[model samples]
Target: MASALIEEAHDLSGGAGDPLVHLPDTATALVFRTRADGRGDLVVVGPRTRAAYFAGKDLAVCVRVRLRPGTARPLLGVPISALVDRTTPLAELWGGAAVRLERRLTRLDGDRRLILEQLETALDARMRGPAVRDGLVGAAAMALSARGRERLSDLAPRMGVSERHLRDLLTEDAGLTPKSFARIARLRDALAHGGRSSGLAQLAAATGYYDQSHMTAEFRSLMGVPPGAFFAGRLPALQRC
Candidate 1:
C-alpha cells in the first residue's frame, strides 16, 4: 500500500509577512505551489539537519506531501544525501517531466483534492520505475525514528550487510548518518514527551537520556538552545510554528 511510502499530504496558508520556524527533521517534503497566473510549481525540500527560519512576506497557499524513508530516491530520482539541507525545484531534477506535472496541477488549481490526488498518482507512477534504495535502510530509519537507541552497526548484521555498508547506504538513502538521524529522532521524541512532563529531568528520563544534563547538551547542539530555554520560550525566535 502507498501508506508505507507516504506519510501525509496537506495544505497550508500563511499571511503576508509571516515568519516561520522549522526544527531539525529528517523527512523529505514535496511542496506544490500555485502561482497567481494559474500555474503550479513543485519544490523539493530536502531533509534538514538543523533548525531553519523563513520569512515569507509574499507567500502563497501551498500543498505539502511529506514522504517516508526509503521513498525519496525512487520518487525523485536522486540520491537523498545530495539533498541534505538543500531546497531544489522539481524542474531542476526531472526537467520537462516536472514541467508537465506542474501544468497538470495548475489545471487542477482550486480543487485541492484533485491536486493531492494527482500528486499521489504521479508518485505512484514514478515509484513503479527503477530506483536505488535499500529496504533495510528504510527499516533502520524507522527503528531510529521510533526509539533512536539502535546503531547501524548493530543493525547491519541483522540486515545481512556489513556495518560500513549499512552506514554508507543510510547516508545515501536517508540524507543523514545513522547517528545523526538517531539524535534527531531522539529530539523529536523529547519534544513529544516533553509536552506531557512537567520538567526537563522527567522528560529526559522518559526519552532515554542518561540524565537531564545529557538531554540539555543534545538540545543545545541540535536545537540551538537548552531544553529550559527552548521550552520556556526564553528566545523569542524559538516559537513553534
Candidate 2:
C-alpha cells in the first residue's frame, strides 16, 4: 500500500461559505478539523464511491492522514467494506479515546505546524497497535495507483492468485472491485494533468482510456462534472485529495 500522511490548514474565518463537494477516490483518511470556536472533531473518511459534500465554513484548520487502500481495515479494526461511501466520526470507532484526542486538540493554542505535529503523534501511537494487513491487497493497490490500465489477467499472475480470488480480496480489503479501483485511479491520473493538457482526446489517450468519450463518461460519473467545468475552476470547494 502507498500510504501518506499530510497536514493542511484552511482559514474560513474571513467569511462563511457553502460546503464543497469532493469526488470519490480510493484512499481512506483520518480527518481532524478545528472550527473557529476552538471545537475540534475527528472523523474517519471512508473509501467513497460517489461525490459527497462538506461545508467549508465549518473548518478553521484541517489535518488528514490518507491511508492506502486495504490498510484502514487493520487500523480501524473492521472490514473496509463496512465503510464504503461513508464518513463516520472517530468517536464511534475509537470511543473515549477519540473524545480525549478532541479535547486535547481543542485545548491546544499553537501554530498550524505544532497542531499538525501533535496530530501526527497521536496517529503514530495508534499505529503501534496490532493490525491485520493484507499484503496482496497492498500490492494490488500499488499497481493500480501507478498504472490504472494494467490488466487484471496479468495482475493476478504476478500476485500468484487466480483472478476470481483477487476480486474477492479487493472487495474485502479495499471496498471496491478491481475494475472500480482502476476507474478511480484513471480519473485521478487525468485530473492531475487536466490543467496542463491541450484537449480532452489527447488527455484521454494519455491516461489510458480507449477514447475521449469514454473518459468523459467516467469523469461525469465520479466527479459530477465534465472535465471542462472541473478544470475551469468551478469546483464547489477546494479538496486536498
* Best of the candidates, TM-score: 1
Candidate 1 at 236: error in angstroms? Answer: 6.0
Models 1 onward score TM values of: 0.88, 0.82
lDDT of 1 by residue, 167-206 (tens): 8877888888888888888888998877689888889989
User: How would you encode candidate 2's per-residue C-alpha lDDT over 169-210 as one tens digit per residue?
Assistant: 888877788878888888889988987899999999999989
What is the lDDT for 5 in model 2?
Answer: 30
lDDT of 1 at 78: 79
Compare the candidates by lDDT and give the number of the best one: 1
Quote model 1's TM-score: 0.88
lDDT of 2 at 77: 71
What C-alpha lDDT, on a 0 to 100 scale, does residue 63 get in candidate 1?
Answer: 84
The positional error of residue 16 in candidate 2, measured at the CA in angstroms, is 5.3
Q: All candidates' lDDT scores?
A: 0.79, 0.73
Looking at model 2, the pairs that clash are 19-55
